[model samples]
Target chain A: MNLPCIVTALPAESRPFFEHFKLQGRELNGLQLYSCERCLLLQTGVGKLAAASKMAALLQECPDITGVVNIGIAGADAPIGTQLVAGCVEDAGSGKRWFPHLPPLRALPDLKSVVVQTHDKPETQYKNGIAFDMEAAGIFSAARGKLDSSSVQCIKVVSDNHSSLVSAIDKSQVFNWMASCIPVVDIMIDLMADPIRDQVRQVDEFTESAAQKVHFTVTQLHQLHRMTTQHLTLCSSLPTLYGSDAKSILQRLKDELAATPLSYTNPMVKDA
Target chain B: MDTIYIEEQISEHPRTLAILKRYPKARLVSIDRYNEVFNNASQNFRKQKQNPALILAKKEGERVLPTPDQYHIGGQHNYYFSHMLNCIYDCRYCFLQGMYRSANYVVFVNYEDFFADIETITAQHKKPSWYFSGYDCDSLALEPITQFVEQCLDAFSEIPQAWLELRTKSTQIRPLLNREAIDNCVVAFSLSPEEIVQAEEHKTASLEKRINALQQLQAHGWKIGLRFDPLIQASEFERLYGRMFEQVLSAIDIEAVHSVSLGPFRLPRDFHKKMIKLYPDSKLLSAQLEYNGTHVSYPESTEKAMIDWCEATLLSRISSEQYFPCVSS
Candidate 1:
């Protein structure tokens, strides 16, 4: 099963996932491009707009990327440290709300469904509810119209109380804390890989079938000729069974012969 | 000349009708006419395409003239005056969209009636009165045609106690630059972070362009005001707003500024519901919101947090006296 290419807005947020996927290469830009046996990881920047742009660039760079999982920290109304899997990302600025599909997280035991309100700042804890951090909203907004909703997920760990968390932690500590959430990242990556691979297989089968229908080999053409001969023999017998019906059957036999797959060996053959 | 399209001619109740009757010379075109005007490419806003009826018919409103929530303007007795009906900019959260049916610009060209009413209101109140423009539409957005602000400034300059505030997101300051800055008038600009402006405020001037205009206005000695109204929720709001405030303060002379007002995402309940219906897919409108009486504002705690944070952050640079929380009264 091919796992999704996991992208994080913050390098610290992507650390655990990046560490899990062994680095296979580096880009000319000097950013390390890592690839595990099943997963791919790229660092997106902070905030909704920045994160969204990065995710888009990543998708363009890797069109084969079937699924995108945006992982990071969020502020919640629940207990400060509780983890949440965002079901929706609401842009507080534009009042646009997007619902994401996370089948893997849904299957988990006691996984909480949350609506992450993306704000310009870390909201101080209000009675309304927990608000998630910056990049998720941008990531979702950018991805919503671009990526299939079924293939995008935002999994976040509660990093702080809205008010105190911003003040208590230094920049480095926030990065370290994000780096430690690797186990959760691995499980989400593994969960999504199977479905993506299955989708690829289905697409491959469809492509092959479409290609075969438009192009025929020598063997297929020969087989088609044998079938036509049998069909003609049956048409020759139809007149004895029903007089007028034989005429219609003969017309159908001619149409079928015209529609038969042509051999590629013919000079007039067209590419499918 | 931009053709005015009127979708419907609703005869407002007697009181409202009386106000319209005062402007007997003002033309009333059918609503279909507006659709035709908007359908033209040259007449449309640069942002998003226009939708909904452009003009809204309101019968006599006792508060047709709404009192500007004073606290919002740093204790100024602010009264918002709308000369036109709708805004050219299609900001996603604008109340005018929800409050009115039409998207066409309705120019109540009977500048005489509006000025007469303002004269009466100012005479009744002896205090220094600040009359705000662009409450329902951008004051200078369509100034090329309307010339409403220019007329109002001319009329209000005669009244020593009357102050006109042309609150807008437009860099159309040519009207103001053409004339002397009315001592009583403060040309305020509604500013949002660059991100919000690009993503949500369709057709509004860019923050950089707006700041440049503001700097020019300040250099010319025009009284300036900064409005951070309807702040959006985002992960980097503080950094964005803080940076925005810092940038404005640094670019312009702070002392020449009139006042600064900060508000959160808030809408009147009816207006909010109407806006939501207008934009069912709008992420800003659909977010969970609690009603604070008739006002549909963010939850109290969220509102408080946002306001308090803004106040604290703004106070660090400007004095508390310079800041106002245009709270619902």
Candidate 2:
């Protein structure tokens, strides 16, 4: 699977991810890009618009990066340094909400699940029991537009709550809170990335080699691919291509497959 | 459902309140409308299916819709209504996975509106009409939670001219058994061979359980239906389905059966495409199927042969008058 790209709002929030993932700093398409073998971290300047723009551009440049993890610091009613995984992200201005596909609780047992209300500026005087952030909705909207909802996730560490004020928060404290969340953050990244890996279809080397031997149109290739998938699935192997011509071979394959009784064994069933 | 999304309009609705009381520990989120979450663009159906939340909203607009020409039992005028959007069971071949982008269940709590619409439609027809439930979801799957069937039975009792078909693969029949069997309601159960049930229909009642439920309902004097719709193909399908038919027919007094329907496994072109994407490794979706313009199904001759075999087998057990083969429009 392609490495999950981690999008953070500010450099302070990105620092823990950078050090943890050992991401090397580089400039990509005029945006601050950090990367390593495990993940890619993009530091979008604070706020929703910047996160959306930078994240969209990064995903556009790297189309293979299907999974996106938006991690940042947030103000909530919880104690400081508490990590949260967002069940829903709502734009306070537009009343728009995005529920990122939440994995099973057991997969994220350590982090509390909360609704994240995203605003234009940092939120203070937290109420309503929901976490407040500036960029979760933006990152989610952009990533979901590019990838599936299952591939997009946002996690935040509580930097300020009603007891503590936003202005009282410092970069060193933010870094410390994020550093504490690295274990759970790693789990979330793997949880998002694993599905993409499982979704990848096994490469059909035989089909590729067969296409090389015989020229096929674009439409023919699609048909051939589906036909080959069915043939392999039912018969467990493809019939030999005896004839030199593509039409004759295709016809022979189709004829043989039709006569084969449509039988299937469910993979989930044991002793099938 | 761990989290319940309640619309502000129906937050205080009696049904909504009852549901809230049932799931007391559920996280409640207030929404202006259901589509704000349900009809959103970026929702993923497969992932949501794993841990789906319930969206309790008042269904607005045209709640009653005319059934497709091919969908009916005996009545000339047929319609279908959905009190719930998604089913609890996940059959690999179900079209709901293709039709809706979200797997979250949306239960329209306004049962009075649906019954009112049904009443209006029946009155407009001025004749016996059929209103089929379970088109978009299994009729009795979440019976205890929704209590939809109890209210539906009461609604149908008031309108004797209208026929209510509660098609399901669920074994939740206690609610029906607790009340007197209404003549206008037919408690239909969707049956398949045990092999198919085990393989494809995930989280549904076993064939034995469904038969047991139907038999109890039949004994209670409720009209029961046998739905052999979406007939799947197998190498030894004749033997498998034949044995199943024997088992099912022998269990119930065939004379008590209200109707039996047969349909081939088929889906609209777009729905088939979407389903294939959701379950690429599914052998059922990967079968060497034929596409006839707008829908996909078994090869013409193969489908005809299977139907012929099933028809012949069923004919031996029941008369032709009770059979209904669903034909495509």
Q: TM-score: which candidate is best?
A: 2
Please state the CAPRI-style docking class of candidate 2: acceptable
User: What ranges in model 2 sit over 4 Å off?
Assistant: A19-32, A35-38, A93-95, A109-114, A193-199, A204-213, A235-249, A264-272
Q: Using lDDT, give the best candidate's number.
A: 2
lDDT of 1 by residue, A178-246 (tens): 565565666666655432244334434543443364453555444333333333332322111112333
Candidate 2 lDDT (Cα, 0 to 1)? 0.83
lDDT of each: 0.62, 0.83
Candidate 1 Cα lDDT to native: 0.62
List, residue by residue over A76-140, the lDDT tens digit for candidate 2. Answer: 98888888888778989898788666666666766767889999988786875599999988887
Off by over 4 Å in 1: A1-272, B1-3, B6-77
The DockQ-based CAPRI class assigned to model 1 is incorrect
Query: Each candidate: RMSD to true structure?
Result: 28.8, 3.0
DockQ of 2: 0.41
